[model samples]
Target: MKDILVRSLTGVVFIALIIVGLTWNVWSAIAVMGLFVGLGLAEFYRIFQKENEGPERFTGITGGVLLFSGLCLTWLSWADQRIIWIPAVLGALPFVVMITELFRSKNNPIQNVSLSLFSWFYIVLPLFVLILLRGKANFPFEAIFPIGMLLIVWTNDTFAFLSGKFFGKTPLFPRLSPKKTWEGTVGGLLFSLLAGYLISYFSGLDLTFWLIAALIVAPAAIIGDLFESMMKRSLNIKDSGNILPGHGGILDRFDATFFAAPLFLILHFIYF
Candidate 1:
């Protein structure tokens, strides 16, 4: 319990610093996301390492570096068409795997190649969108992009856990996550919608945009939560890492954002 409190508080503080830094300058935000991309890629590769058949040593490190480099290089573009960079990066990852596999033919080449590809798409690519969206200058509600989304996600998680503990009756997906319930899902949706409205009111966002965001984000957040839960269960691990007491790891904490950010970015670009 003490560990949970300490970890939560520390997380809030660190996140607050990142938000402030991001709102202040685009470069600062990119730097922060770049670091996260690196860390997240490392975690993904580490998980793959546990498979024992994958290229655990050199390929894992290479995947991490490539993931980070892709994000960093995308920022150099002046146009918002930066998402186009992803396919190019995706194309290169396989070549990297094949080259490495030829030299080190001791391991299963197919598993090694697949692991490299999966890490890029599953972990790094989604995070790249967060940096791109947050760094956009023309977006009127620029300051709220990262912070508001973070707040909504955190609030949804808190309410879901509390409501589930007290009032849960029906399960949402018992196999994937035994603890998540319909009551929790309802609670999270309500909180997320409320959060969306609050951001609209406080951050000068249009009600239309907020409504759209809420509709889009609430479910994506839930999907993200379940996705990570599946990952944990697959690996037979309780948490992604013990770095944060209640939160688990960087992956656990940011799982919702990984899905939500990309969803929001797509909606923002397409609709607004």
Candidate 2:
């Protein structure tokens, strides 16, 4: 009972922070998302923690921040689109990875270097996509893009659990996640789709657009959760980290966002 209360309260606070970050100004969005990127990268690197075999934390994190900020600049068009700074940072990151491994005299130089590069893609890129989705892409309520995106994901998560608790019979994938059931997955998708279809009534977004988003985001969210579960299982650990008491880590909280972001980016561009 106490654990349930703690989890519920943490979830509420997490949702509240994300909502404020999105609904506030643009810089706040960058700052808040940037903070997530930084911490998430740290946790991700720590997953492979070893003296020399693990990823280069400082270089990897710095590169991630630069990658996120550069993309934001390109999207915001607040600076010269042709700015060479982005190119310079991108060019230097790989060398930083390799050189750091050389100094470490690490046996798994391949593991260290590759993990750093993969971290940028796995963790950094997805978070950056969230920023892209916030573009005022013809939606009357610009806030709705991020808020609605989050709402769909959250609604699915909530309903899925309720459904599974009450009606779960068949396991979704006993290999990766033993607790997940097909009933829960379907319930979550149905609820998310309904929420997306209804969002048009409350916001300026098109019914069809949101419906499609729900379709994509719901299953993608499940996949994200499963993927992270696989990661933890392979790593021989339980939660990603203990950062968000009861909720695990930033990855545990935003796994859905990571998968949903890129697909939403394509959606935003196509609509534009």
Candidate 3:
């Protein structure tokens, strides 16, 4: 009970900060995202560290900085047409850094390269998406995209847990997540559908778009959750981190959003 209250309070504060920062100014929002990306990457690194195998600390730190820089460049690219150099800047910074890190080490080259590349994809790529969404033209919708993804994912997870506890019959993925069940999944999907409709109605998105998004969001949200569970099972870890009491970590809270947000951003790009 205490855990739930603490997590709920933390979630409220976090959302409040996002809304406040974005409404205040683009830079403020970017700064907030920078902090988010930084902390998120750090937590990911910590997870790797717990396993006794991770990228070189120096290289990882450099990657984190480059990721932040790339995000900033993405922001600048949106603010000006003549300033199209921003994407180029964003691309080159990480590429050069990763390449340099790769060549600097000759031992177990495959593992090192994988770690370097994976960090870029896992840690930095989403931040780049967040920056793009924030700065995209004709998409006042971008701001809502991340928030909507987060909300839907949260709803799915909550309902899935509750439904599974009360009415779970057949396990959905017994090998991966023994606790998940088809009943929970269906209930969660229904909740996500309702969430999508509500967000669309309130946010002025089209009904068809909302329905499509619901279809995409719910399954992806499940995949996101299951993927994290798989990773934890593989690593034999219980939680991603201890930052949020019962919530585990920011990663625990945002696991579904991590996948959902980028996919929703793509949906916005393609359809909205």
Q: Which one wins on lDDT?
A: 2
Per-residue alpha-carbon lDDT of candidate 1 for residues 1-272, written as tens digits (9 for 90 to 100): 88778877978876876676568666676677767766776667666565356565566566666666665665656466847866587467668777887777555778777767776677777766766767657343575776777777877888888989999999999999999999998998898889889988987778778777877787888899899899888878877766655567778878888888888888878876
Ranking by lDDT: 2, 1, 3
Q: Name the better of 1 and 3 by TM-score.
A: 1
Better of 1 and 2 by lDDT: 2
Tell me how far the alpha carbon of residue 167 in candidate 2 is from the true structure, in angstroms, after superposition.
Answer: 0.7
Candidate 3: C-alpha RMSD to true structure equals 3.1
Comparing 1 with 2 on TM-score, the higher-scoring candidate is 2
Q: What TM-score should be assigned to candidate 2? A: 0.93
> Model 1: which residue pairs collide?
none
Give candidate 2 regions above 4 Å deviation: 78-82, 136-140
Top-TM-score candidate index:
2
Better of 2 and 3 by TM-score: 2
Q: How would you encode candidate 3's per-residue C-alpha lDDT over 1-272 as one tens digit per residue?
A: 88779878887887788766554556776787777766776776677663345555566656666667765765666567875765666567546655765666555545655666676676667656666666544334547766666667777888988999999999999998999999999989899889889998899878777777878888888888888899788878888888766678767766776677788888889995
Which residue runs of candidate 3 sit more than 4 Å off their true CA positions?
50-52, 78-107, 136-142
| TM-scores, all models, native as reference | 0.87, 0.93, 0.85
Candidate 1, after superposition: displacement of residue 160 in Å? 1.1
How far in Å is the alpha carbon of 89 misplaced in model 2?
2.1
